[model samples]
Target: MLDDYGLIRVAEREAAYRYAVVAPQCPADLMWPDIRQSTLSILDAVIKKHAIDKGRVFLTGFSMGGNGVWDLAAKTNGIFAAAAPIAGWYNKDEAVHLTSIPIWAFHCEEDDVVPITETESMVQALTDHKGSPRFTRYQGFGHQHSVMYETYSNPALYTWFERNRIDS
Candidate 1:
């Protein structure tokens, strides 16, 4: 999935940043504890072993990982410089807590599985809380198509990621 983000190309083309992809060993439904813990563990290891710039760390995920992105970012508290969740659903009740984090969400209007309203309501809650999160909805696409179409070649998303920093 990290390949979809052009991360390898980005790393090869530039020397200023490093990227790592963590795949949790669990099914999607069991993602809450198992996958979340795995991701956090990988993140902890990365920070400890590498000369990483904490302020520039970013989080991104698609599908189940997308859902994990929202949950993890809120729980971690000022850890990620920015988060981008693709085709993921977030709990609307937790929206306000994400106000300080920069979020860029992507989804499809015709996604039958997750439904577009999942992301819509979360984005609305964020807006209601005076948070500005960038969102993109592919008008005629479905869940898988939207992610597959946008993931690899979106130059703007990468540029946006570069502009954010957590300062923690």
Candidate 2:
């Protein structure tokens, strides 16, 4: 998975979605942090380089990358319009500080790698603070299924993302 080979397949599909998949020349263990920093850097560069609407910027990920989405979005505060963390996990305490932005979480009930409890606990913490987040759990799906693929394939997900804009 550390190899960027699979991303080529995603790029080939295109599917009307624009993505900037970054691959840092680092060890596998460092990829997560690299992705986090690079994503922010890319967004900063894009905002400065083009006529960015600002309100339309979004962050999303799957599995380990899903955890990255939560971490990055939470850290950025008002920078991202919305976040969709698929089968991700994060510290519940950190989640409280993320009430400013909307989050849509996806998880598979049969997920064994991260456990569905992780997402449920995070969602509970977020909702307990009156945070508005949408969560959908695939009944029989397992951890291996690609949540991002499922998310992108569903038109409703794109529509939902398009509806929300960052309110600063």
| Leading candidate by lDDT | 1
Q: What is the lDDT of candidate 2?
A: 0.74
Checking candidate 2 for backbone clashes, the offending pairs are none
Candidate 1 off by > 4 Å: 1-18, 23-26
Top TM-score model: 1
TM-score of each: 0.83, 0.80
- lDDT against the true structure, per candidate, is 0.76, 0.74
lDDT of 1: 0.76
| Candidate 1 lDDT tens digits, 26-101 | 4745765556667778878887788678888888777766788789887888788999987888789998788999
lDDT of 2 by residue, 34-87 (tens): 666776786788777776778888777777777777788777777888888888
Ten residues in sequence with the least summed lDDT for candidate 1: 1-10
